[model samples]
Target: MRDLTSTEEFHELAANSPVVFMFTAGWCPDCRVIDPIMPEVESTFSDYTFVSVNRDAFIDLCIEKDIYGIPSFLAYANGSESGRLVSKDRKTQEEIEAFLSNLSK
Candidate 1:
């Protein structure tokens, strides 16, 4: 996944492609669990945009968006919020795929 390190990059990405920006902290167990499997998401949605945001690096944005939990997925289409899939319990491959596939249309 591409690293979205700055607000400019985040906005640019969200505005450009059918992107999914994941808000996760490095220390979060749920994030660690999902990290390795993200390659599958990247491959599956090769035509769509996929990005990652480090919560520690961008806390203000996270709070502004109310990203209270790790593994929160902010799915955007042309810079708008299309959907969200969040929480430790819901961060699964199938869940992610389902959300991405449904919105990809």
Candidate 2:
């Protein structure tokens, strides 16, 4: 997963292709819990471009998008939002996979 560098980059990526932005932060335990499984998840859903966005660095963007949670996922396809799995709860691998799977439908 690529780390988000700038807000401009976020917009450019979202507009260009199927992208999944993962909102996370260093201090978030829930975010770290899924770190080990992320590589596998990315491979399982190879069609989408995965990005890691630090909640601290992009607080403004988070507020704009109404993301009041850590370890959230926002998917974009064809320049529009397709789905989201936003919450303050810890996400299991199955749940993450299910969310991505549902996005395809």
The C-alpha RMSD in Å for every predicted model, in order, reads 1.5, 0.9
Residue pairs with colliding backbones in model 1 are none
Candidate maximizing lDDT: 2
Report the lDDT tens digits of candidate 1 across residue range 1-105.
888879998888778778888988778888898888899888988877788899999998888888878888988886688888866564888888888888843
Taking all chains together, the TM-score of candidate 1 against the true structure is 0.89
What are the lDDT scores of the predictions, listed in order? 0.83, 0.95
Worst 10 residues of 2 by lDDT: 96-105
**TM-score of each predicted structure versus truth:** 0.89, 0.97
Which predicted model would earn the best TM-score? 2
